[model samples]
Target chain A: MDVDTDVTSGGGTARPWPIVDINPEALAALESYKKRDPSKVVVRFKAVGNAPIMKQNFYKITASNRFQAVIQFLRKELGWKAGDPLVPHTPPRFASPQLVLNKPQFTYINLAFSPAPDDTVSNLFKSFCTDGHLIVNYSTTAAWG
Target chain B: MSQYGTTRGPPQAAKDRTTDYHTALFRRLSWEGTVPLEIRVDPNELPANSDRGLACYFVQAPRVSYLPLLMPEIRRFLMDVVFDEAASKSLKEEDWWFEIDDGTLLKWHWPIGLIYDNHTILTTIRPGPSLATTSTTPLRLILHLASPPTDKLLLAANAEACKQAFMGQLKEADFIRWGNTKRMTGLRKADQDGLWEGIKEHNFEEYWRVASKVTPTTTANRPQSPGPPPSSVSMHGRPPSADTSAPPERDGAYNVRSVPVRLYLPDGPVIQDLVPPLLEDGSPHTLAHFLNTHAPLLFPPQPPAPPPSRTNPNPRPPSHQELAYPLVQGILAPLDSEMAWLGACLAGADGWVNVCVGISRK
Candidate 1:
């Protein structure tokens, strides 16, 4: 029933495959690993709902930049027209639509209203995002109250 | 002909007609998704011993269709009870459709159909017809219990008129201005009276005046820059390998960035002695990954000591310190993200913030 027993028992010495040892090579690499550039943070956007995905959804943004940077990028990609008299067909768009907070199992909390335009992406990301990249759901209309 | 000279009591048939109308209205609502809410009309408002004191109604029907059904009912009730025949007829022929708020904001508008659903409404106004109009006070409206079989109008105000009165003052623009603000968590229907009681007790004007202001950016656009060009380094679910062959991975490298964070022990012994001063990383490290890789440095498991040494027969019991490592839990707290960066977490503090690392309690 245990197929692994044959190969493992063939050798008189039966031990786990990974017999790790202390090596100086691993230690010498620590210095470079500790350092971080801090100037830029990468953003990977994934579309949710009926929102269209960008051709290139990945981009590096300055960590200090505000969340509006992402909003602005999304508006441009979607070809949304602002309230302009000349653009009569275009509807007036709210500067901030609902940005929902999502984690794997946690309830989908509506980041309703606040996290003002001035709030930095890095701060929001550190406060809410998961993994290295932030995943946000963008919609033309408010998804939740 | 009904009342020639003396004031005759309202016709007996009038009472029966009112009952018929109410019965029909309720039967229609039973089929709709929304539950018909009941409002206990004041005892004084109704005629002597009348059973029609309570008003049962719903807000599911849109203003366009609702006005036709509603306006006639109000007009008839006024003529029969409060007004004389001529006085009720002379009342202005105004449009009731325009009376309802047509706000595009989340709080002001709900899609029609599900008349009974757990809906959360947020607004900055007080809960009555008379709105407290001050530029600063934040208002919220929470309508809950849609799919969940909960009481209708579960909060303090249950009347259809009361809900509409709250909606009347909310402008769409005000919501757009406040939507991105991170300060207010607002009230919810599920939050038993405590949240409502707190809100009700506070004077909106006085609250705003006394509260320390954390300035909100009402209007501002993001600074424009040509966004980053596409890079070949795609981290599509695979672990990132160190750039060993290329130039040494240094602080100045394009991809390397540090999110410094402060960490501490909530219950375990002071961590400085147990772990290294700094942990090495290139890719982002989740709390689980960070602890797993550094297990040897942080919490090395002790092998059972070879029985009693012949030299010393008297064996001391293993100290409490030598016990197996307790299961550790990490928290970003306040900011409860799974993979929060060390640098971003530290950015607010002088250099780093003290995050606790302790045995998982729950």
Candidate 2:
């Protein structure tokens, strides 16, 4: 269950809890929300309840400059290699666009904007979680990692 | 083998084969164009039939192979125009397959098969079609049978001699210079014909390995670029994540597991590279971690379990007709009333089949 909270893209606000399962439709809306304020990256968040979740936290990467970090994260933290498909992912969304500490179900996160937009589907990226909602890493602008 | 009549059409010469090959129910889909399929960026990641982006230039389908039988006119045209320009000066300039693409900048040494038993000249030119579209298109190529001629020399001991000759040719062969063609070629297997014959099939790496076999590796190494600092490489069970450099979360939870995979009945050498590659220290690549990233796409839904029912009907009585032996009767008589005893003797039908019997003196 998604709840949309209208938060301005500023440094003050903490990110919302992210949704694990992301739908293309939600990506469109989140993309629109992000476009609402171009200066700052727009992130989506929600709290989750007792749903069986594989233990892992997911993050949406931005900032092409920090692409090296993202690569290191995959290779070092996640451990990927060349010739591998990109990770599978479920960019998240909320039923209501409002702020709430508690969500009915557990959530995963998507960047609203994917760094790798190739149409090829792979088992590479997966939905994960973080303490906060709307996972946004301003560290890098998206480019070939 | 029969000699080809200079008239050139396959006509009666290939009739029997046409019927046999076409009769096959499932026509094996073959990439008829020229360029290799699955061009790999990293040659090391080859051997298995998987890739990241795409290395298959697929830039364009090369010049038509000019099948002598399929399109005799085109073959004649090209022969007069390209292979034998001096002979056909009267042919129309437009009829010649001129620079539909660009001209070969220069010739280079390329390793070829029996096709170039004679020295072959090649050039570097982008195939014409690629300039417009990158997508692969369907085309057909047929291998003509080299019929035997009556005038050829006959030697009873030519078998081994012929083999040696072929091997001798390979021993002296050079490189397979890329000519002016391109196309994506998926792994393909062949039929009774040797075009893709005992050579296995169109496995990109299989082709590479086969090539590696023919092209001996020497002590000579390619000039090294004191290349950029090497990135520490890792392995993965699945495709690697696109963004690897992201900062690690101070507090995050996840699980990774490894399961033994079995290729129970591989039809061919397709699974040669199924095993994920290992790193220097013998650890998997980073991509392995991301393998479990997607649930639905990667792992399909499991099948439903069978229904549960607990009941045992009486066993069918054994046919006790002509049991002349008491031992047979002793074995058969307890048929119905001895289930409990049989249960003790048996493993209870849970699919275990074994028993232990010991005789003791009282």
Candidate 3:
């Protein structure tokens, strides 16, 4: 008999793998995940300053998706590759030595803060969405202070 | 509270002074907090004849600082211990990254304390003669000087790259707090330089001088009158048609738009939500409210079940177990701590409250 053969192949004494039941309490805890809305959120993109505008501004993305997805989507639509440096519109006074050295693409929400890449779409939609859409502003240059 | 009134010139000023005193004390503690680290080199990166024991280096890293800041000293120490001049010359700061025991690549951009807390689970060991009773264990990290996992981790090429990233985070936090980056953008070039210099030099006074302007200290500096709610701030950085006359109040008392909070969840992506400082009814929101709102599964609204009762003797654990603890500046802050107060005093050098959720094994 091959040692690698199934346990049940030759011996009547072979026993089935032990089956352990999961805690019902732990199962009930998953109700929170079940309660969350799995619907897609509408993200509307608007160009600021010298940034190019997309033909179709509205997109429906999974609510659980990160804001980074929106950024990558915008980058794809705008034909800008990742790590490509854009001309910064930094004012003389605002420009520091480090700003010139490392320049990443700028994307803003509500013309306000740039959400981190890891921020969830649902959180942004819940907090900042207006008119049933989360408005995202993108710029190749530093659009606003 | 009455005793303070008796000793001071004016009650309001005295209160402000007391608050300031406390804020300074807390801020100093946060700045000076350090994490004990045991760093080891990747065996592949070391010479074949190198002694494993000699390769390990131990240091107390400041919580507020970044790994890249201490890279030079760590590299120098390693050179003196294991490598020859030729081998050490090949080692560069830009080519380094750190890994935990479980092969998790640490993000260099985050503060040292955050990285440690997020990765390490702290269990309180019972006090005994032979064993230490400290709750914390030394964070063990493996340093790689070869290929970096660029896909997972951002490149902190050099000190300059780290500085740029830090400035970027400051602007992000400023925008979140004020709905605009004016506080950061309006900073003079010297003050901007000072912020980075202060952290490098570990000068509390120097850092706060520049940082205080960027962060809102009291209600006085926050927006007093609630003009158009943040929802009205239009997409183009302009107010909507209805509230065109009065632009959002850029500065006022108790007017913090949102608290820049980064919640680090174990086995999940970081959650950065737009957390308003005050509720609609002008009440301060607490850490408990914030966590309950964002992470209901981990921090359920229901209170923990009572201990074993007399009749029951042994009660089943709660259905929704509170599985994690929120740690800020290496301490479990009271859940009732006000968001505004926490934002002002306990934020990291990047101007964000980095709350690391340490998951319990039990």
Candidate 4:
């Protein structure tokens, strides 16, 4: 495979740091320079399938915050509890009404895969942002494979 | 062997057999690995009259297993000693969370070994003469039964929620490696269930039977069935190869589209990058290449060469300086080890190479 040759070719050239060392204070300062003020990044939410759309699709979030903040924000906006079912429905006569919780809503980046809740917003925006905005896709059902 | 009908030449067949053996060995070792743990309940959460002797529970935890899986047994052993009857009755499985001695919240979704590797990076720092005691000491964790840190950790509500999260990670890894999640989502329901069942039951054969289907193989002898084009926008351009549908390989060197790598930096942040398996010229990407690209400041591009072999026959002396060490599967992986092989063999149950980088104090 000549893998050794390939390893050495990309070995020596040290590129300038694209992503700064993960210092919370330094990261916040660096992000502030990229945006207007207060270290916020623009996040655009898009509804998938029959999911309800938000009145304000674009929200400013702290760039250093983890992605879990976005999920919590969307859940609050949709009036859905953390573990609540995506669609509420009436109970059957034969079964307990409280036990019929449908699938929960899911969030994705680029409609490809679910980013971990711990993933930092700045990292996601740097890697997958489109048109200078981090596009977050939320769906009530399994929208994409 | 007979199924190939001599399509595979003798030497290639031998190489394939060797690779398969090593992969199986690695998986087996990973599955069987265990970490000695000294688990104790947070003293503040314990009842006033709790028995001090029974507060701590020691056990060897399976490295690949989730913390939630051991909750019932651990709670049973220490519940009476820690929580009063009323508190015990009110506590639920999701109410419990674990923390290291330093109070760092442990992510339930991460494998136990990965959690240990991430937190124990300081133990691996070379040239530190005083780290011997800490390195050999059993990992001490505090179990909290109240006020789980919801913001810092995802709520592992129940076993089902934990399984779903694991599946979500697997799909993420598959998508990162193939630029799509079709292979993971396309698995038959039974096979998909089997993958989780295997992990829950710790059955190596059952897990690999389905995992092998999703993981790309080095051999390019599979059928040329071009699946549907990727529906979502590809972050990286597709490799210049005609058979885009085929399981990842442009040649022997460039096998997988991208290696799903999550680097746990010593400081705190976890860096997940879309690292291709090979460099531009199709050479295997090594651990050094990955670190140089991602955390260049910690791991300089051209590390100081080891003192000349003739002068200092022992390349690794007592005072040798190592800027950083990348630990994969709880072992110090050589810098020259190829990412392709590590991703294939040492990836966590979620199918991502989780490298814990330990920066030296010096």
RMSD of each: 29.3, 31.4, 11.4, 11.3
Q: What is the per-residue lDDT of model 4 for residues B1-362, given as tens digits with 9 covering 90 to 100?
A: 22321212223442352344455677778778877788998888775667766789988877777887777788888665665677667777678788987778888777888877876774443222212224555788998877788777785645676777788788877766766788888889899999889888878889888888887554433221233232112336653453465443332323456778888765466776667666654455788899888776666667354786777876653443345678888887888877876777778888888898765432
Task: For candidate 1, write residues B318-360 as lDDT tens digits.
Answer: 5433211221111123222222223221111011222343221
**Candidate 4 structure quality by residue, lDDT tens digits, A22-51:** 234433322332342247889998877666
User: Interface RMSD, all models, one decimal each?
Assistant: 22.9, 30.1, 10.3, 10.7
Interface RMSD of 3: 10.3
Worst 10 residues of 2 chain A by lDDT: A117-126
Candidate 3 colliding pairs: B219-B253, B219-B254, B222-B252, B222-B253, B223-B252, B223-B255
How do all the candidates rank in terms of DockQ, highest first? 4, 3, 1, 2
Residue B68 error, candidate 4, Å: 0.8
lDDT of 2 by residue, B1-362 (tens): 33322211222331222212211111111112233211112233222332323322222222111111112444343343333344334333222111102221111111111011111101101112211122232221121112212111111112232222222222211110010001001112221122222222333333333232222111111111232111212222222441133322111000011111111010100000112212234332222222222111221233444454355244343432221110010121221211111111211111011111001101
In CAPRI terms, where does candidate 2 land?
Answer: incorrect
Reference contacts preserved by each model? 0.01, 0.00, 0.16, 0.19
Error of 2 at A57 (Å): 32
Order of the predicted models by TM-score, top scorer first: 4, 3, 1, 2
How well does model 1 score by local distance difference test? 0.29
* TM-score of every candidate relative to the true structure: 0.22, 0.16, 0.71, 0.73
Flag the better candidate by DockQ, 1 or 4.
Answer: 4
Query: For model 2, what share of native contacts is present?
Result: 0.00
- Model 3, span A18-106: residue lDDT tens: 22222233234334443545789999988776565555789998988777788878776555332244545522321133332233378
Best-fitting candidate, measured by DockQ? 4
Q: What are the runs in model 1 whose C-alpha is more than 4 Å off? A: A1-38, A80-114, B1-197, B203-362
